[model samples]
Target chain A: MLSCKEVTHLLSEAQDRKLSLTESMQLKLHLMVCKGCTNFSAQMDFLRRACRGYLTRDTPRDDD
Target chain B: MTSDSPSSPRVTPETLAALRTDMLRFATLQLRDPHLAEDMVQDTMLTALNKADQFAGRASVKTWVFTILRNNIIDAIKLRARTVSASAYTAEGESLDAAFDTLFKDNAHWSPATRPVAWGDPEDALQDQQFWTVFEACMAHLPTNTARVFMMREVLELSSREICEDLSISMSNCHVILHRARNALRTCLQGNWFTASGCATC
Candidate 1:
């Protein structure tokens, strides 16, 4: 059971896919039990998707 | 596959389009200004085109484009920082406590027990302009240095050492700034911008 602070740190790293396997497991386990952390992770994931879409639009055409 | 001529790989139009799409997305995340992001992507494409023969295949095409995009964003933000009149002290003056108070102090409606807004809705808000607005506003609220470092590291996907060299900050300070920026964003997004009512929050 990670503290809120630890979970927060893990969430950021997890988003980057930078966590070690053990650390990833711990974060996942904590997320399963903690609704606040789960929601926070989900929000981060949502933001990444939003960013991906925003970044892909408005690209210059290659005339392909 | 190594070519016998030792010449660089050809950057086909398909490759440029893929790179542009990626660079644009990354720049948009960091700049929060589509125009600026577009310009950055354009600049990246121009540079990549000019240096097409420099493609060593040491990294993926995506990684190379992202590196260029990150560098461009840093340059843009640094230029903006120079033009802005805000001093470091004044920028950092908005204490975390004060920011929290400023948002929630007046709102008698805020509840810790409030049901969090479901972010998974297929509505275009999460995909289009509104998300950028919220993201941009949240970024604007960060302290200048903190925001710069965070954007370079997280959104731009630069390494900490790379950020340290670019920003001329120590590694420890870089980490500190990054930590502060992430925490601030996490709190801001959760409390204000991304709540159950969406607008009810940020």
Candidate 2:
């Protein structure tokens, strides 16, 4: 199982692109019991959504 | 598709004027410079007016004008891109914070205080303008250079290689820097808005 730090690093990398199956599986497995890492990943998801909503309220978001 | 039909692109005087305002706001967010954003918006207006026929109603007037503005912003960044002392950029005086040291023991497990709580519906915060204000504040909290790299990657959606080339950093360094940035941002958001009892405050 990946440690919190290891999983968190992969979590950030996953934001840029899809993780490989092995990496995803490892992350998913780690996240299953690690509440802290889960919360951290969820926050990353929120950041992505919040940023995309930065400009385009209805559709396209230029906030990248 | 139906919003900006071929029948009408909605380029009225008032709409164009309003587009300018939106363009300026959008540019300001991307460029983070009011004066530069104004120039960008002005350039966007000029380009749109000149290429009025080219719009073709493929997108809404706002989208078309903002596209011009976005390109202008990118050009502005590229033009100003240059090698600098890493010391100068990272010189915002922020160092690896000591507080983070306590988050992990020798074994790299999360300390008790470091355990994050499950945040409630993030969508609720997304819909709140105050939440954005708080988020912007959190983003601004990062050291200036770190924030720039983060924006170029996440905001501009630049590839990792593009970031390394643009910032003259190594690939691994770019990855490390992004990890730091994401960590900082996620922590701040969790503290301020994501917790079950978080104030959701600005």
Candidate 3:
């Protein structure tokens, strides 16, 4: 089983590149059983979406 | 004036100037040099004005202008990379091993206090102004180069290969920096926003 730490690293890496088949399988298996890793994966997705959204969103003016 | 589609948005100097503050902030964050950021934003404004006739309404004015700024920032980063040693771009004072050590156990599981918790339905939070504040704070908390690389990859939408080549880092090093950045930002947001007891404001 992939450890949560390893799973998180792979989760981050998955953003930049495609995971190998064995690595993907291992990640899927671990995520199925690990709620924490599952939540972490979801948050990573949210972060990416939020970053892209940042470009279009209006930031309040800072007069300072 | 040449005949133009009525749907095209008019690009005014005032409109572009209004967006300057945000553009400068974005440039400054990515470049980490106020003067260079100012120069890039100024150049972007000039280019946008010169190309005002080309503006189409398919995207919002903000999006179009930002696209120009993104290109300028990328060029500036590449130029700096060529002029400066690659070591100067390294994430100073940030140790990825130490960061992981704090978040994981000796056995490689998440440490009890650092385990991830559910942050329900973050989509709606994207519309919340307070949420963006927390998000920006989390981004600002990242190590200098990590934030730069993350913005390049996530905001500027640069490929990892382009980033590696621009910063003169190996592919694996770029991955490590990006991974560390995500971890840091995730933990920061969890603590400051989702898990905080008080108001969502950072």
**Predicted model with the maximum TM-score:** 3
> Which residue pairs come into collision in candidate 2?
none
As for candidate 1, its clashing pairs are: A55-B25, B117-B196, B192-B201, B192-B202, B193-B202
lDDT of 3 by residue, B78-135 (tens): 8775444446445352564466567778889988877888998888889988998888
TM-scores for the candidates? 0.54, 0.81, 0.90
Query: Which one wins on lDDT?
Result: 3
Question: Tens digit of lDDT per residue, candidate 1, span B85-116?
Answer: 33452357357535434332233322355423
Worst 10 residues of 1 chain B by lDDT: B102-111
What is the Cα-based lDDT of residue B127 in candidate 1?
45
**TM-score of chain B taken alone, every candidate:** 0.55, 0.79, 0.87
Each prediction's DockQ? 0.16, 0.42, 0.78
Displacement of residue B178 (Cα, Å) in model 1 is 3.3
**Pick by DockQ: 2 or 3, better one:** 3
For model 3 the TM-score comes to 0.90
**What TM-score does structure 2 among the candidates reach?**
0.81
Give the range where candidate 2 chain B is weakest over 10 consecutive residues by summed lDDT: B193-202
- Stretches of candidate 1 exceeding 4 Å from the true structure: A20-22, A58-64, B1-70, B75-94, B97-111, B114-118, B168-176, B186-193, B196-202
